[model samples]
Target: HLVLILCMFLYINSVLLFTLRSKSVFCETSRYILLYNLLFADTVYLISSSLLYLLAAFRIKLTFYMCSVVILPPVLVYSVSPLTLTVMSLERFVAICYPLRHAVIITIRSTGVAITLVWLSSSLNIIIRVLMLLCSNTEFSFDLQMKDFCSEEALFRVPMYYYFVTAYSGIVFLSAGVTIICSYIGVTLVARSASTNKASARKASQTLLLHLFQLGLILISTFHSNIITAAATIMERSHVLRLHSLSFIFLNILPRCLSTFIYGFRDQTIRPFLIQHLCCQLK
Candidate 1:
C-alpha cells in the first residue's frame, strides 16, 4: 500500500509537471500523450488493487460505499489499459511502417476513437464481471489459511466470473504479444534496410531497444496473469495452496514494483527526466 501510494503520488506529480512544462520542454506531443496515459493507467491499477489487498491484509470489512467508490473503477480501468496498449502498439507499427501515410492515418481524432473503443470493451467486461458477482449468492471473504494478500478463494468460487475474467485477460495478453512480435519484426527489417546510414542505424537501434523493454514489461505482466490463473485454479485444493500463494505474491506484486523501475530507470529519456525531477524535489 505504501508503494502504491508513492507510485500514485509520483504519477500525479509527473502529470502536473508535464502539463506545466510541456510546451517548453517536451518536443514529442504524441510520446508525451502516450506516457501520460500509461502512467494514469498504472496509477489507477495500483490504487484499486492496493485497496483490496489492504482490506484483506488487515481483515477490514469492506463497506458497500468503499467497494463501489474506491475499488471498482480502478480495476476496470487497469483491465482496459492493456487493450489500449495493444492498440497503441499497432498504431506505432503503422506509424513506422507507413511513415508516408502515418499523418493521414493516425490523427488525434482516430487515436481518440481507438482509445474510446478500448475503454468501452474493457467497461463491458467490468460490467459483466460485477453483475455476475452481484447476482450470485456467494459470500465475499478472505481465506484465512492462505497467505495471499487478496482472496483467490472468494473470487474463484464464482466459476463464471473467473471464466470471463480469464478469457478477456487472455485475449488482451495474446493480442499484445502477437502485435509486439509483428511490430518488432517489421521494425527490425526496416532498420536493416537502412543500415547504410550510421545515424539512421543508431536511431533505429534506440527505438528497437525501447520497444524491447516495453515488450519485456508486458511479458512479465502476462506471466503474472498466468500464475494468477493457475493459482486460482488450485486454490480449492489445500495441498498446493501454499505454493500457489507464494508464487502469486512473488510473481504479481514483484512485477508491478519492477515495472516502474524498469521503465523509469532503464529508458534513456525517462531516466534523465526522473533524475532531474528528483534533484529539483530534493533541492
Candidate 2:
C-alpha cells in the first residue's frame, strides 16, 4: 500500500508539474480531458485494489467492513478504464481524420455523456457480480488445505454464480479486445494516408504509440485472465502463485511505472513540459 501510494503521489506530481509549466501551444481540450480521465481511473485502482494487495502482503487482515469499502472502486475503475481508452481512441481518430467536424462532434457535453456511459457500463459489471453474490445462498468457506486464495470449486458449487462470473469475464474481455482492434486498424489507416505531411505524420505516430501502449496493457490483462482461468481449472498451487505474481507485476505495477514514459515522455510537447516542470521545481 505504501509503495502504491508513493507511486501515485509521484504520478500526480509529475502530471501537475507538466500541466502547469507547459505553454498553451496546443488547445487540444479533448486529449487533455482524456489524459485526466486516465489518471483518475488509475488513481481509483491504486487506492482500492492495490491497497488490498499491499495489506495482504503485510499480513494485515482487512476487516469485512474495509473490504466492502475498498472493493467497488477498483472493480469499477478497472471495468471502465478500457472503455475510456476506447472512447479516447475514437475521439483521436475523429480529430485526426475529420478535423472539420471534430469541434461539432466531440463537444464538452458529448464527452461528458460518453464518459458517463463508460462509467455506467463499468459499474454495472461490479453491481451485477455483487448482486449475484448477495442473492446466492452459498457461503464462501475458506479451505486451509486448498492453498489457494479462493476456491473455484467453492464458487462453482453455486452454479448461478459461476455462470454469472463467466459471463462477466467474457463480456469484459471481448468488449475490450474488439474496441482495441478496431481502434488500431482505424488509426493505422488514417496514419498511412496522412504520412505525406510531416506534422500530421508525427502526430499520427504519437497516437499510434499511445494506442500500442494501451493495447499492450490490455494484452497483459488478457493474459492475466487466462492465467487465472488455468489456475482455477488445474488447481495447481505453484502455477497459481506464479501466475498471480506475474499478473500483479505486469498489470498493476508495470503499467503505472510505464504510463508516463509511454504517454508523456514520448510525446514532443509533453516531454518538454515535463522537463521544464522538473527544472522549475528544482530551482
Candidate 3:
C-alpha cells in the first residue's frame, strides 16, 4: 500500500513537471519555474526517502558509506522546498507591492540564479553535516555495516550531527517562516489598497497563504521522525512502528503530493494543459 501510494504521487509529480515544460509560457514565468524546481526537489526527496523506508521494512542493512550516499541527497533536497517557498513568497510580495518594478526585479535570469543559490546553499549545509558525522566517530570507516535500520535518525545519532541538524532546521525554518509571514502581511496590506487591482491582489494573497500552509507541512514532515522517536519511549514497539508508517504517509508523502494540485488547479493558465497532460491526451 505504501509503495502504491508513493508511485501514484511520483507519477502525478512527473506529469506536472512535464506539463510545466510543455509550454514556453510556463518555462518563462518566474513562478512556474520556481514551482517546477519545488516539485522536482520534492519528487527527488520522495524517491530517496521511499527507498530508505522500503529498505528498512525489508530489514536490509547498508554499510555506512552506502547509506550515506543514498540518504545524503534527501537531506540536501528536503531543505530546498522551504527555501524555494520563501523565494516564491518574496516573488509574490514584490508582484503585489511593487507591480511596476516586479518585472525588472524578478526576471527569468534572476529566478534561475535564485534556484541555483538555493541548491548551492543546501549543498554546503549537507557537506558540513557529512563532515560532522564523520568527525563524530573517531573509529568511523567506510566498510562499517549498520546494525540498526538505515534512516536519518540512525545516521544522525551522534551528538554533533543531532545538534547541527537541530540548529540548521531552526535557522532555516525561522528565516523562511519570517519571510513568508512578512510577505503575507505585505500582500494583505496591498490587497486592501484601492489603488491595487482587487482581483489580482486577492489571488496573490491567497497564494501566499497557501505557501505558508505548505511551509507548515514541510516543517511537520521534517520533525515527524523526532516525534516518532519520542513516542517510542512510552509506546510499544508495534505501535511505534505503526505510528511511524502513518506519519511517513501523512507528514512526508502527503505534503509533497499537495504541491501539484495546489498550484495546478489554482492557476488558470496551467490548469487546462495540466489536465490534458495528466489524462495522457497528447493531441
Candidate 4:
C-alpha cells in the first residue's frame, strides 16, 4: 500500500514537473501527446494494482468480476505504452530521416487518430478475450487466490488461456521490438549521413536506446511469475511472495517513471524550471 502510494506520488510529481505546463516538454508535439497517454495508462495500471493490493491486504473477496475489472483495464491500457513508444520512435525517425516530409507525414490530426486507434485496438483485444472466456468455459478460468494479491499467472488457468497469453505477449514483443529497432536504425543511419546534425542524431539515438531499455525491463516484469517461481526454492515462501508483490508494483510503475525522467523531464522547459526552483529554494 505504501509502495503504491509512493508510486502515485512519483508519477504525479513527474507529470507536474514536466508534462502539465504549456512551456513543458512534449507538450506541443505528437510525441508529448503520446508520452502523456503512455503516462496516463501507466497511472491506470498502478491504480488498479494498488486497489487490488489494498483489497487483498484488507481480506476483501476479489470476485471474478472484480478481478477482471482490476486486471483487464491495466492489461489493455499497458499495451498502449509500448505501442506509443514505438510510434514515438518512428516519429523521431521521420523527423530525423525525412525532415522535409515529416510535417506532411506526421501531423496533429493524424497522430491523434493513431492514438485513438491504438486505444480502440487494445480495448477490442480485451473485449474479445473476455468474450472468448465467457464463451468457452473449458478454455478459460478465473483463478484468483487473493491471500497474497495474485499476479497475472493467477488470472488465467488451462487450455486457451495459456495460448492466448503466450500469443498476445509474443505479438506485442515482436511488433514493438521490431518497430523500435527499425526506427532507431533509421535514425542512426540518417545521423551518420548528416554531419551537421550529428549531435541531434546522436541524442535521438540515445533516447531510443532508453526507450528500448525500458521496454525490455517492462517485458521482464511481465514475466514476474516465472522469475519468482524459478527462485522460489532458493528463498523462503514469504520472501518470494513479498519480492513478487514488490515486482508487480514496481514493474508497472517504475518504467513509466523512468521514461518520464529520461524523455519528458530532460526537456528544454523543465531544465530552466528546475534551475529556477532550486534557486528559490536556496534563497
**TM-score per model over all chains:** 0.68, 0.73, 0.95, 0.83
Query: On residues 186-270, what C-alpha lDDT tens digit does candidate 3 reach at each position?
Result: 8888889899998988888888888888888889887897798799999999999999899999898987877897798888998
Which candidate ranks first by TM-score, i.e. highest?
A: 3
- The per-residue C-alpha lDDT of model 2 at residue 151 equals 23
Runs of candidate 2 exceeding 4 Å displacement: 1-28, 138-159, 194-198, 209-213, 222-246, 256-258, 278-280
C-alpha RMSD in Å of predicted model 3 compared with the true structure = 1.5
Considering only N, C-alpha and C atoms within 3 Å, which residue pairs clash in candidate 2? none
What is the TM-score of candidate 4? Answer: 0.83
TM-score (C-alpha, index-matched) for candidate 3? 0.95
Ranking by lDDT: 3, 4, 2, 1
Please, what are the lDDT tens digits per residue for candidate 1 over residues 54-128? 675477654343445555665567555556556656666666667778778877677677767877887887787
lDDT of every predicted structure (CA atoms): 0.57, 0.62, 0.89, 0.72
Query: lDDT tens digits, residues 6-89, model 2?
Result: 575566545643573355543346665666676667666755656666654565544333455566676677756667667777
Clashes of each: 0, 0, 0, 0
Higher lDDT: candidate 2 or 4?
4
In model 4, the clashing pairs are none
Is 3 or 4 the stronger prediction by lDDT?
Answer: 3
| Candidate 1 ranges beyond 4 A from true positions | 1-21, 24-28, 138-157, 195-250, 253-273, 281-283
Off by over 4 Å in 3: none
**Candidate 4 per-residue lDDT over residues 1-283, each given as its tens digit:** 7765666556454444443454534466676677677777766766776676667666676656557777787778877878888888888888888888988989888899989988997887787677667776654445543444544555544368778777877788779889999989988888877353888788888888988988887787677667777879799989987886787657755775665577545766555564554345364
